[model samples]
Target: MSTLSGKTALITGSVQGIGLAVAKVLAGAGARIAVHGLADAQQAEAAVSAVRSAGAPDARFFDADVRDVAKIEAMMAEVAEWGGADILVNNAGIQKTASLADADAATWDAILAVNLSAAFHTMRLGLPAMAERGFGRVINIASVHGLVGSINKAPYVASKFGLVGMSKVAALEYASAGTRETGGVTVNCIAPGWTETAIIEAQVQARAEQFGGDTEKGIADLLAEKQPSRRTSAPEEIGELALWLCHRHAHNVTGATIPVDGGWTAQ
Candidate 1:
């Protein structure tokens, strides 16, 4: 458990699900949170309140629609003015399921913009300061799709794979930026599969209903095709991994994409 006192974490898409979980845990470690996501007024304020309650010294919401470069720039500027991000989590993403033939150009563009390009923009804007400070962490929330191909998800899979490759490049670029004591800058990806987030709720619901309300069976059914562990990871579990990477000792763990897929990729 590393302390992030005086540190500021900028997590995109942090209003709910995995992103929110990351914010809460980082907040518990005394890091100020720069929460960014798309949500209504009440939900946005609630997100801020959640992190504060989780023990953040302070938390501010940034309304950045990551698909737009201009919005990301404005958001980064605001965060920079407040003291640039020490930890940048590229957790914002959008996904649409469609086969190659059915995947339209607009869908590809949107998915690529949010899932891949947003990370690039944020890192470009944030990493320099982290290098100057001699400490930085960029944790990208990629997917198992990054490691393997899946059906009816051409754009999503492409974006995740691109994200993984991009992180590797960034990691190499900044590998020697900082020293061990400074907790050197590092870029990494967490490739998660079948996590219990809203992203998979529809599948879960449909499966559960398919099995006559037998939720456990439905989950098993869903996991049958992959996920040998037959388990769905919780969002907080992913947060725990992110927190570990933020530790000073994790300075050397760059250019790595860790899988939390319950053996889905192993198959």
Candidate 2:
């Protein structure tokens, strides 16, 4: 069965964008959702409701700021008591655009804290139990920047690159934790390039207005220089790949940094 029937999925930054999209797909596969994010009461509730409606046996939101290690530890303890994160998706991330010389200390700290260090904490807390159980899936939401780079995004690039490196270490460490019968412990990254998320909506809107409100034209124009496919991936597309990885068939697909970047990395 392609079902995570008795599993619990803890997805960070799941209130919106790729995180939320991933949550819904896992829920649809019958996994219970342990939602985490920095969202208001209304938005958090909406995320839980969305997952539940998508087919989760249950869906509950865990409030925690990923940038804070103490908060993340507290949330992990709570999740352990509830059950345990059978599948952990480190999707919470923050980005700021700045030149290498211009990037401030605080900005660098915040970006690394949320994007890289936070995943370290969660994996440390969650992977042991998974190893004991002989099954787990750790999906880190990295970026195309993890594999390459561009201008005016020093900290963001550094954080993503760090994430990619860290995930490889995790993958190798737990590569032999399970067998064919069990799904096995796997750690992987989804390196998405210019997906249609709120993160890029402002840019899209600005370009769309410039092109007489033709959003398609705006998207095409924005992706022209980079993404060879010239179309941004839908958030749901990323979610679908995450779901595929969670399936038992993908047990051997550990340590992979799969790109849904419309061929950006291919170049």
Candidate 3:
């Protein structure tokens, strides 16, 4: 039987990038998928179609702004009515770079709302039902910055670190009862390093503008200093790890902040 043959997985920010990749991977593993993102009806449908095409037994899209708690709650309620999710992947996030001396309160609020608080909201709304059902998987897509520091990304770092702590607490709360021999619900986090995503591309562009319009030099310096592997991670690779965290074989693994970064945190 497929690992997730009878499970339903809900993934946020799933319209593109890491979220989209994770959705497709889970769908291919036989999980009925709920793709959530901030998008119009047409765009949402397109994502649903893509998931279905990737081999999901069933698929749908939920549109909501993660920064809005009320909207997130409403969306989760709607999802619960449609048969609650068995796997919740908190993959939605936004990156706003700023030094502490120059950080704006509004930007900090927005970043925290999306990157950290959205996961909290989802877990609060999603966990009780999971505990009741005796099965659940909560995976947060964090970053290497959660484990180590970098320049000019205070909000992002703080949010991811908070998320790691939250995941550990949730795991302790929801771990299956029974001498730790059997597996039930689990919460874990993945801290990815630099990935070749739109976000990274935007950062590269910004660096190029700052460095006399030399994009290659900007990317090279970024890679040389950051990822020891000198290569950006693939979203699909992260997707595979996310799938593993949801599998029955990984039942014993919980509360860990696993890094998929290319040796970024090691330094």
Candidate 4:
């Protein structure tokens, strides 16, 4: 495990689910934490408290509606007051399950704004400082859907694919800068499979109900159909990978989209 002592990490949409899990993992490794999430002051504070309990040297929360560029910019500026984040995790996302014909334009635009465009806005603002400092980590949390398409997920797939493409471009631009003076900032994305988060739990429950309330069968059927491993990933597993990517040893790894999808994409 790499120690992130003295470093600051900023993760967006971290009040719950995978985002919160990542925050806790990074905090446990000794990083100061800046948690950004939607506008819920109580939830935001609880997130900060979790980070603190996880042993982060320092922790704070910033609430903003990431779809609003102005609000995101304001929040970033506030975080900058504490000398900017050394690691940036673009983990904020929204999902809509609808076919192309069934999906409305408003939902598509909303998904894109939150899932794809917000990452772009944050990266544009956050990467400069990392480049100047010469050491940074930018991890975008994409999904298996980014690599392969799925039914009823047109908008989500589109946004994630765009995110992956954007990550590669940023990686190429910054690939040569991580030297002794420059802190070897690496840009990468993680495409997670069906994971055991609140989101997935809700999905499973819905599927279970659809199958006459057989929860285990619903889980088994879903995993058997898609993932060869026949299991869901733990949020901490994704966080651990994110932590590894932020380590100094991973400095040489950039512009890559590593899948933690339990062989979902392997097929």
Colliding pairs, model 3 = none
How many residue pairs of model 3 clash at the backbone? 0
Instruction: Report each candidate's C-alpha RMSD, comma-separated, in the order given.
Output: 1.4, 1.7, 1.9, 1.4
Tens digits of lDDT, candidate 1, 156-211: 99999999999999999999998999999999999999998888776777789988
Please list the C-alpha lDDT of all candidates, in the order they appear: 0.94, 0.93, 0.88, 0.89
- Summarize candidate 3's per-residue lDDT along 7-89 as a digit string, tens digits: 89999999989999999999999999999998888878888998898889999888888888899999999889889999999
RMSD over all Cα atoms, model 1: 1.4
lDDT of 4: 0.89
Alpha-carbon error at 46 in model 1, in Å?
Answer: 0.8
TM-score of each: 0.96, 0.95, 0.94, 0.96
Model 3: residues >4 Å from true position, as ranges? Answer: 177-182, 210-214
**Candidate with more favorable, higher TM-score: 1 or 3:** 1
Best by lDDT: 1
lDDT per residue (tens digit) for residues 22-72 in model 2: 999999999999988988899999999999999999989998988889999
Query: Which pairs of residues collide in model 4?
Result: 134-182, 134-183, 134-184, 135-183
lDDT of 2: 0.93
Off by over 4 Å in 4: 180-183
